[model samples]
Target: MNANNIVDATTRSPARVDEVLDRFFSLSTTRAATLAPAYEALWKTLRSNTNGGKRFRPRMVMTAYEGLGGEDLAAAAHVGASFELLHTALIVHDDVIDRDFVRRGIPNVSGSYRDIAHTAGLSIPTAEHRGMSVAVIAGDLALTGAFRLMGLAETNSATRARLLNILDDAVFASAAGELIDVDFSLYSGVPSVEEIVDMERLKTAVYSFEAPLQAGAVLAGAPESVISALGKFGREIGIAYQIVDDLLGVFGDEHATGKTTIGDIREGKRTTLIAYASTRPEWSAISHLVGKSSLTPAEAQIVRTELEACGAKDFTERLAGEHADRAVAALADGNVPQRLVDELTPIVAAVLERVR
Candidate 1:
């Protein structure tokens, strides 16, 4: 596909991604009859997550594949589904850890189970346990399903092996990053800007961008130069994406973003903004309120006000812009087709706008 063709395909991002997911659902539905009833419920949760979002990871895969000269649309679709499934699993697991009961304005996987328990008149403790259990199982199912989908892609064995290797490393690195995130949250001292950037690259960038891009390039038989360039693009963009996400988590309106402004503050997420603010003398005034489970809107607004007052917000924006520039530079070095580059050009801007 030429770059113009790729641009045309971008317009169908939702329909194409959903079409890929629908095929998987059809097969899963047939298999559901042979599985335990609980498994079916979990599948429903997976379906919910799959149906929402812009399917950013899958878009990355398809765009990279087509950009690299792969022509088999069906092959791309199946591969796209695999990445989507992996992302869904990650979100489910993240929700479980954050104790978030809702996503996309609906009860999340765990929240669905919690609702069921609530309907059954279970106590809060029991309901919460049921919710957590279901979310864990649901996440596991999605994670395994992702690999299975990858295996089912219509590709050569050698190609699949390479893709799997890339994916496995991404998953491992992402997990290590997650563990570090938990540790960072528990520390009394604020994490440094460098540490925060490094953590975001590992925790949010790898599987989210790097693995999918590398896998796509590998499937397309692209050269190591292209694959390496895509890796750099993914890493830079992914960290930028995460940093913008952190900004939104604290400053964005819930109605517009579908994310709670107070959640990160309540969880004490170790974002660069918080780290920068910590260096300010005002840290002593609001440090205790950051991780408080009872963090109110008033308290969250105070943090936001201070984040802006301390110049952390601008610092974060500058950092994100710097990485975005690096991402574009990486793409420029890839010998990437102009049209392909054209298709990807908007991603950096879109990510920046996420803070709104």
Candidate 2:
């Protein structure tokens, strides 16, 4: 099979999942509308915020389900939709953690409320606090909404329970990872490369890759060995995915990523790149600028230059390639079908393709 065709066919943001999400949002807004107009507005804002994603997580579910020869596309669709909901919930809370008001270059739930508060004559600090408060509520709603979506899947109680457990694992691992990520910034010294890798794996790899793939396998009723192999592949690829994302966060086109490159630098996130850079003598040149909130574009440019000069970019690229290679190697497990291997192989390259 043409890997590109398979990818396009399998991963085009399934309309079925979108329909499920649409119905979910509609019912949610209707219930909220009955209570208060502000509640209705909150749901509407969340609905807006959750739109325009690539829906990769849901598609992963379908991919594994179909690949493993499972029928019941509708059941897979509901489970996949739940993963997407979980993704939205996490990112909404992540934005709040990052103190970001925008997502996909638009005003996020927090940003929308913050702007409204500001226009209503609230002080900037007050407006920001109000925005964060509303965003927290919005995030909470999305978090619970994810489990609710899972419960909607037309599957037996046993299978549904397993899926819920998988989702809970994703949520649990993600929270641990997010906390570690936050704590890294508070350290007086840069975290080790190993520590950074572990943090990245927990924060993004598990939920985005491992859980989705495993969920698909479980939904398909695959054997334990195949499920284990997919989890390994997903975990490795997910690490590479986040590494490339970190690369993009510092050096990529804002239009392509729909994110500001400088934000990571400003936040002083102890990414692998930063961790590696700290070991280099050149890092001292721009050390003071790494975490400065009011960092100027020119200053950011200087930091970028130092990072490049110190070979941090090159090192990070090599690290991502290593993980990608390991991800492909994971498919060699005898239990994994060759057809599945071929279709999934392209994803490793695809993960690193964005930074190139």
Candidate 3:
């Protein structure tokens, strides 16, 4: 379970994961058709979205399981698929909340419905409603599918319960985090830097990284200490991932990320970057520019200039590095096998370097 071997294990999971997911979707297709023609159409788009994104979450589960010496890859793959489905469900709801029409360069769940409505010559307002409705239903469907998939994992009743409990906790935490995120944006004053980090952990860290690793560890019969240690490491790395994501939201090439560079600023999304910049006096002049749904390109550029001048960019980058260091140190402190350490190195790199 060295780094190379970890990579090898992960490399083999893609096809196996896809194979299981394909079956899952086929079942969905039949179920959706039974629901209605629109449901059938939604299932097709869900399948498309499933095929589009890289299955990193599930990979985390499988690698951790195999790294810990779990020989039952079939069961591991099922759990891995469950995590990916959970992600898919959440993202669909997320898009509805943000009114985001696209993800990874294509129409998101709501956006797909929006596109369909547009093709059918619906009015803008009607189309928007349709989009939101479809996305919500789609998200619910995916969430239920995720739960069912986890229930089917080839493990004992006790282990199955543990896995489901982990998934349930993660879903609860993620929902709370999303709610907090909305509330944070509505705060009268700028949130503290600590708030952003805390939100990052609750929102993105636990389920995306920690839950997957813990789920795998549990199935592999790893001790509670190992599971707890992996959880901490996931938290640190998850925070780093968010920091880099915030950076990319503002500065990375839209062509690469398939997101509008100005979206975060325009949406007035609260992030650590904003918290850091708010400490400076110059923030008052440009503060009004952010959060405007109709923000112009020139205004976005102006805001960007001020953010850079106030040193927020540099501060965010430095702080992200510190978090990455902490994550690595936590992994060491966990005293996990060297193989687990090696298995997780890319996750650390992805967060710190923002490559994947």
Candidate 4:
């Protein structure tokens, strides 16, 4: 298929995943209502949290499944939706860890609950605690909801088992990656570029890209060799995707990306961009500005200027392109089908499309 056809196909996959999620939420909402009104409110909040996502994980699953001529789209849909739920779970927990109250320019689950607590006349500290507690419970629900969706897949025993294994690996690797990421942020020493790259791969590549692609192949009953190839492709592109996202976090137009450009710099996120910048002389001038919760927009702008002049931005861009190239090379080396390859190659370009 051509690129347009591939885009159309992947676009349809989100609709399929949405169908599955709708059914799951419908049932959950009813059950929660039976439990208590507050329980029902949590489910409503969760359903809202899961909305407006890019649905990238589900698209990856469907891409591989359909590309390989998989017949069971229903099974694939359920599997794809599971990853989306997993994505939600991780981000919800991450917000709690970061103590971030906003997401996508609005109040997140924690923030919403905190606002509710405030309206209820709770003290600031108590409200904050309540928000965090509710958010933790909400994230747990999403995490378990992911596995529940997986179990709803229509596939037989053997295929279901394999898919579950892939999901398990994704979850395990992502949790480790998240822990290491938090550790890196807290540690005094600067992490190596290689280490950050590994962390990125583990945190995002496995679940967001690799597992979804691999699971789709398993659903299609693809050979082990092909599954391995797709996983590699997913890893390379996933890393590139994240690196570019880091770039966007610093330099891209917040209005265009719908994410804060200053948040990463303020949080002292140990990204590949920051890692490369730290080796430069300009870093000394701006190092103190980082991680300042009260960092002003003007100060953040200075940090951005230093990062650009120090060549960190250009170096990181080149690194992202190199990884994208490697992803293409994997397809060539692995003898992935021409149709599968053609569809997948465009995705590599799409990964870097934002920062450009």
Predicted structure with the largest lDDT when compared to the true one: 4
Error of 4 at 130 (Å): 0.9
Per-residue lDDT value at 114 in model 4: 92
User: All candidates' TM-scores?
Assistant: 0.91, 0.93, 0.92, 0.95
| Candidate with better TM-score, 3 vs 4 | 4
Q: What local lDDT score does residue 187 receive in model 3, on the 0 to 100 scale? A: 72
**Model 2 misses residue 345 by how many Å?**
1.1
Model 4: lDDT to the true structure: 0.87
Candidate 4 C-alpha lDDT tens digits along 1-356: 01222244353457889999999988999999998999999999989999987787899999999999898888889999999999989998998998888887788889989989999999988897888899999999999999999988999899999898999999999999999999998976678788999999999889988999999999998888899889998999888888888898899877666668898888888999889988989989998987888999999999999999999999999999999998888888876889899788778767777676
Give the Cα error of residue 222 in candidate 1, in Å: 1.2
* Poorest 10 consecutive residues by lDDT, candidate 2: 1-10
What stretches of model 3 exceed 4 Å from their correct place?
A: 1-12
Q: Indicate the TM-score of model 4.
A: 0.95
Candidate 2 — which residues are off by over 4 angstroms?
A: 1-13
Model 2 residue 327 CA deviation (Å) reads 0.9
lDDT values, one for every candidate = 0.80, 0.86, 0.83, 0.87
lDDT of 1 by residue, 183-299 (tens): 896777889999998988887799988888888888888888888988998899888878887887888766766678898898888998998989988788788988888999899
Question: Per-residue alpha-carbon lDDT of model 2 for 1-356, expressed as tens digits?
Answer: 01222245454347888988899999999999999999999999999888877778887887888888878888888888888888888888888898889876689988999999999999999999999999999988988988988887888899999999999999999999999988987776899888989998998889888998999889899888999999999999888888888898899888766678898898787888999999999988988999998999999999999999999999999999999988888888738887777768778867777778
Residue 92 lDDT in candidate 3: 89
How well is each residue in 67-138 modelled by candidate 3, as lDDT tens digits? 888999889888988998999999889889888888866788888888889889998889988998988988
lDDT of 3 at 156: 98
Candidates 2 and 3, the one with greater TM-score: 2
